[model samples]
Target: MKISARNRLKGKVVDIVKGATTAHVRIDIGNGVIVTSSITNEAVDELGLKIGADAYAVVKASDVMVAVD
Candidate 1:
């Protein structure tokens, strides 16, 4: 899926935690890297986001503020 946001991170789905109305999708970036995002239940089911699946974590923020890590 394409989004207007430029800060998009792509990875393979590693884990999925389902909740009452939300689900957490975990993606493996590489070299033991992992990132998770909270998505809607409908998105989880519609996109078939599951373990060992390819997915893109597109992050859209109202502001693009940054700080030194």
Candidate 2:
């Protein structure tokens, strides 16, 4: 599928935590680095995401903020 996002990291689905309306999907890119994304449960089912499934973490954000105290 064609996408507008450029930051696409290929990885494998490691874990999935479902909530009432949202779900956390974790993907292991490499070297013990994992990225978690919170999306709707319906999206999870539509994508057929499951453990050991290969997928891409499509990162398309305008700004990423980091704060430390």
Candidate 3:
């Protein structure tokens, strides 16, 4: 619980897909890493995001575009 965003990714919430108000949270920020976010759905039941629990996928951006072919 801090202010500044530092692209934190400490996760274990392996999946949660809802709609009609957004909710696509997936986190597994380990060796086989994964990080997905689409909050809302009442902030996923007011941050009681179940499914293995333990989460933090904060990726604030100002300018981050890396595309190659």
Candidate 4:
């Protein structure tokens, strides 16, 4: 409910791909852009994440990396 991270992009869940331990939660942040977060399968279940549901992609500035190719 309360987080310190400022980079919170609200969007609708587009897809969910689950692996052995981690799952990739894809959220469409609008404008044909999607933000994917790799989280534990348990986290995904606990959060009850499903397609067409609202979710937020929380990003920490310190952990973000920029690459120029």
Candidate 5:
């Protein structure tokens, strides 16, 4: 699917921290970089997101910013 988030980071799942109802997902964006985000447990479970899996990081337009310097 096409997303509007400009900072699209494709990475491998490195860690999955579980919460009461949500999951703190950590992905390895290569070059020794990692990104973390919160997602519903159901969503992650439904998508079967696990360590070593490939996934994309999507951020909404309202959640992103591009500053002109």
Candidate 6:
């Protein structure tokens, strides 16, 4: 798929938690690091996300904020 987002991480679905309207999907990108994304339940189902399923974490944002304490 061609997307405008350049930051794409390929990983496998590790866990999933579904809520009323949203769902938390976790993907392991290797080195024991996992990325979690909160998306709509319809999206989760439409993508057929499940444990051991291969997927990509597409990050598309205009700006990112970082704070150091």
The 10-residue segment of model 6 with minimum total lDDT is 58-67
| For every candidate, C-alpha RMSD to the true structure in Å | 2.0, 2.2, 12.5, 1.3, 2.7, 1.7
Worst 10 residues of 5 by lDDT: 1-10
Report residue 14 deviation for candidate 5 (angstroms): 0.4
Once superposed on the true structure, which residue ranges of model 2 sit more than 4 Å away at CA?
61-69
Global lDDT of each candidate: 0.82, 0.92, 0.86, 0.95, 0.87, 0.90
Q: After superposition, how far is residue 60 of candidate 1 from its true place, in Å?
A: 2.1
In order of appearance, the predictions have TM-scores of 0.80, 0.86, 0.31, 0.90, 0.81, 0.87
lDDT of candidate 4? 0.95
- By TM-score, the best candidate is 4
In model 4, what lDDT does residue 6 have?
Answer: 71
User: lDDT value for candidate 1?
Assistant: 0.82
lDDT of 6 by residue, 1-69 (tens): 698986789999999999999999999999988999999999999988889999998887653456899
Instruction: Report RMSD for candidate 6.
Output: 1.7
Count of clashing residue pairs in every prediction: 0, 0, 0, 0, 0, 0
Worst 10 residues of 3 by lDDT: 57-66
After superposing candidate 5, which stretches have Cα over 4 Å from the reference?
Answer: 65-69
RMSD of 4: 1.3
lDDT of 3 by residue, 1-69 (tens): 584765777878999999999999999989998888998889999888999989888876653457899
lDDT per residue as tens, model 1, 14-55: 999889999888999788889888888889999877688887
Q: What stretches of model 4 exceed 4 Å from their correct place? A: 67-69
Q: Best to worst by TM-score, what's the order?
A: 4, 6, 2, 5, 1, 3
lDDT of 5 by residue, 1-69 (tens): 776567778999998988999899998989998988899989899989989999877777688768896
Error of 1 at 7 (Å): 1.8
Off by over 4 Å in 6: 61-69
